[model samples]
Target: MAGTEIFGIEEIKALTDVIERKMIHRYGSHSVRNGIYRVEEFEEKAKKITGSKHALALTNGTAALITALKGLGVGPGDEVITSPFTFIATIEAIVACGAVPVLGEIDETLGLDPVSAEKLITKKTKALVPVHMFGAAADLDPFMEISIIYGIPVVEDACEVVGGTYKGRYLGSIGKCGTWSFDPNKTLTVGEGGLILTDDEDLYFKMDCYHDHGHIHSKAHDRGEEGKFGLGVNYRLSELQGALGIVALDKMDATLEKIRKTKKRIINSVKDTGIKVRPMHDPEGDTASHLIFMLPSPEAAVNFSRAAGEAGTGFSIISQNTWHYAKHWKALEEMGEKDIFGTKAPSYAAETMAATEAMLSRAVMTGLNINMSDGEIERIIRSVKCGAKASL
Candidate 1:
């Protein structure tokens, strides 16, 4: 079961055909044209889906975030507020841009708490990254107000909630700029890709340069004449990946619909099982239902999982904490003394200490993929309810 895949053979075959036909590398050959075309198509499709004026295709979601942060002029000594209960890639991007990530707490909906975010802001605060974690939009109105009052930028990490909406506006489009991931595990995939969407022309131009290595191809380049303007990374997506993205983009609406239906069914099946369903915002708005979540106490979740196994109903927590964030935390801890940024001065930065301790204390999380079948979920729910009685 661990090795069994969720996607069907047709999906794999379709992706493979695109990969085979497009033939990967497009740096300095005619194949570059096809890659560029596919990327353009993906950008256009994404823009329409996200309701943004401009979209840029990039290497991966992390690159999209770093590009957005760099474009916003975030750098060393600058503090950007973000939720700690997210994939480390979000924090990694902040670190890569030489900015400090001031962690914020999450609400029941699992998004950054607007009040908590406001408390973390300071004179050096430069940006706010509100991740639409697990497919639910964060309460954006308050964050938008905070950004407005402070004159700071907001970049929505809509990676997991691309098609999700809040208050009628699309999740990513609600911010100054939004970043999305197209990894295999995401709501949609291009094998490996990302997109950045923005309404600001200047931000669009700057991010283009950031992703491309500080270079913007002239109109001639768009028309097939090669002249370098500056330096940029070769963080461009492959034609095959772009093609696959286009195909996937076409299927997004139906895919998201199925996800919503599956989510409802699973939630109903599990509601009476004495296991807690993950909290969510009103599903009527813009939840893409990316990953189903549950917030059982750690002990309860462990017991439920064990009982599930005995009943032949497999399930798992998000991951063992030892395995989930160890690499990132270990890398930070190894920095040692002077390397650990704020160690030398204990009482020096009260805010930093408070934020760090608060963030670390509230890190428990659990998730289920969107691929579970109805029967499997029902069986698991049955097992959980039975186990709850047995424990009593």
Candidate 2:
């Protein structure tokens, strides 16, 4: 589930170049650094890939989200709607902004249900965030429609699907603002980094100043002397991470190609078993980092999971996976119970999220390896067949 699997001498070489120069800051070290700016270069590369006009690099994805929200002027007494089936970072970013996170139910795409989101909107709603789960996109057209209709900004959380696209456009590029993660577990690893993609120029500058210590960076003014935008935080990306990011971004096409092939092979092999592959808004543009299937019922999912485990090809039952799903988020649950999210004791109980609960409960998935051996693939295929048999 990581891009680190393919790290090699290129990563080492890039790091060595930065270390040998003794340049580790992303900004303002011109004399000794020979005018090199790896973080700027990295942002440029990201903008090119996603066709975004501006890209802001940060310390991690969570910071990117918080900054993007802040740039959008999200703050106290406001509510931001997003899917319940996302990393806790999404909610945390909203909370960090002194805003409330309103969860919308997920549809078959395992993403925020547009209708559900629209129904939850109030005058306080500031934004709509649609998370691209796993390696594929959520249904985005309706979310875009909702955004336009309600005059709400859509922030695409493409963290899990870094290289993935939707309708021939990159996932993050489709929204008013998009964000991606480069954690060690992501398809593009920069050790720990995050980025925001946007076409809005003013929004870009706002985030730029907000990520640093409020100084609007300039070549002439020097650090701390530049005019301040406002109060800010230190989510700056190190030049070291930036150097590694350049190499990681270069490998995205190859990584996506490899993972997509692995997923296609497994999906093709299991199609005859009456199991349903998870739906995607843009199948062709999927990163295909994971192979997920929908069983007829939750009981079948349990059986399938049991069989897969016994066969030594353990599948992730998404409902119980604390890292990705909201049902397991005790902190959020507690917060919601206190009516902190602008709703009265919001529920994570299965009955409350019947639609999302049913879909995630009946789903089982496994991550694909970019460097999977033929023998390993064969074993996985055999194990999937066993699970399918048990499911049916």
Candidate 3:
């Protein structure tokens, strides 16, 4: 079964039409050189959708993360605490800024455990990155509390769950800053792009410069005028991506509804299968991007995954050793001593986060694509039943 699908030809036609218009208008400049009309529109729409005061488009989710970190002034000798159960990009962003990545345990939500994260905070701790993992909102309340108590900034990595909410507030809008990925695999696809959202004008300006080669663009500093440039890199999104993003944003609400319904059907179908399913942190709030369950044991998880594969269910068993899992980061070995700020990278491989490892080892997950047909959903439900019967 296809795991993820892109928008239809209508979206393609819209993007093409926008590109054609830009071509006709002699819009030769990229985002940095000159403001692309579509890029500006997309940013405006993104801010509205995400409920942020400012939204800056970037080349990819990784760029968004790095830019957010830089904007928060995270750097050498700073320790950023994050869950080990998230995508590698979360840790990579922290390390990219010459900061230490402190691994935190995850609760049933598969997000950073707030208590553990609070314990990890030290004088050197500069930020807290809580990933809204697999389309579910992390428990942001406690994290937000921790942030307030410690004076650390929280950067919500809402890459997977763009429209997901926690207690009625959008996932990306609760933290000091939030990021979303528009990669092909995500709910909202622009082929390849990302968004950084923030309410703080100063941080917004900082990230704006960070993503656009350090050039601060404002009313005082127009395109051609000299501005207060800083150390940064080229992470600007193209007009083509911006056009696609606009179309994707338009389709997000309906697509998310379909995904939620499909996820509900899949989850309800497996309710009597004796498998231990981890409930969403908030049923009404989560944006059901993936269906996740846990087996009785790691061995059972392996067996179930193998059986699911044989049954063509397309379910993956996430384990501690998975590349994205935190225990496997081996930060020093992976990042080496390449430092932009001449700081020694902390040894992450030595610290084993037992809770995160235990939680993920027996977990089975599958992507919930909006394009999945009813027949495919039924097939997955049947496959899960068959796999559980055979393996367990």
Among these predicted structures, which one has the highest lDDT? 2
lDDT of 3 by residue, 103-206 (tens): 77888768888998998888989999999887788889988899898889999999878888888888878899999898777778787889888999999999
RMSD of each: 4.6, 1.5, 3.3
Candidate 1: tens digits of C-alpha lDDT, residues 1-392: 11113356655675676576655543345534454456677789988877789998888899999989988888776878887557878878887887666677677666788898998788888899988876788888988898899999899998877677888887778889998888876767767888899999998988887676666645345424554445556678876677667777777777777657765665576666555555556466544443333433445555655665577555455434433222235554343233223322111222333433333332223244445676766765666555444332
Query: Per-prediction count of colliding residue pairs?
Result: 7, 0, 1
Ranking by TM-score: 2, 3, 1
What lDDT would each prediction earn against the true structure?
0.67, 0.88, 0.79
Candidate 2 lDDT over 320-387, as tens digits, reads 88898887877877776455545454555545667788889999998887889878887788888899
Worst 10 residues of 2 by lDDT: 341-350
Better of 2 and 3 by lDDT: 2
Candidates in order, TM-scores: namely 0.80, 0.97, 0.90
Better of 1 and 3 by lDDT: 3
Q: What are the runs in model 1 whose C-alpha is more than 4 Å off?
A: 1-36, 222-230, 272-276, 285-328, 333-374, 387-392
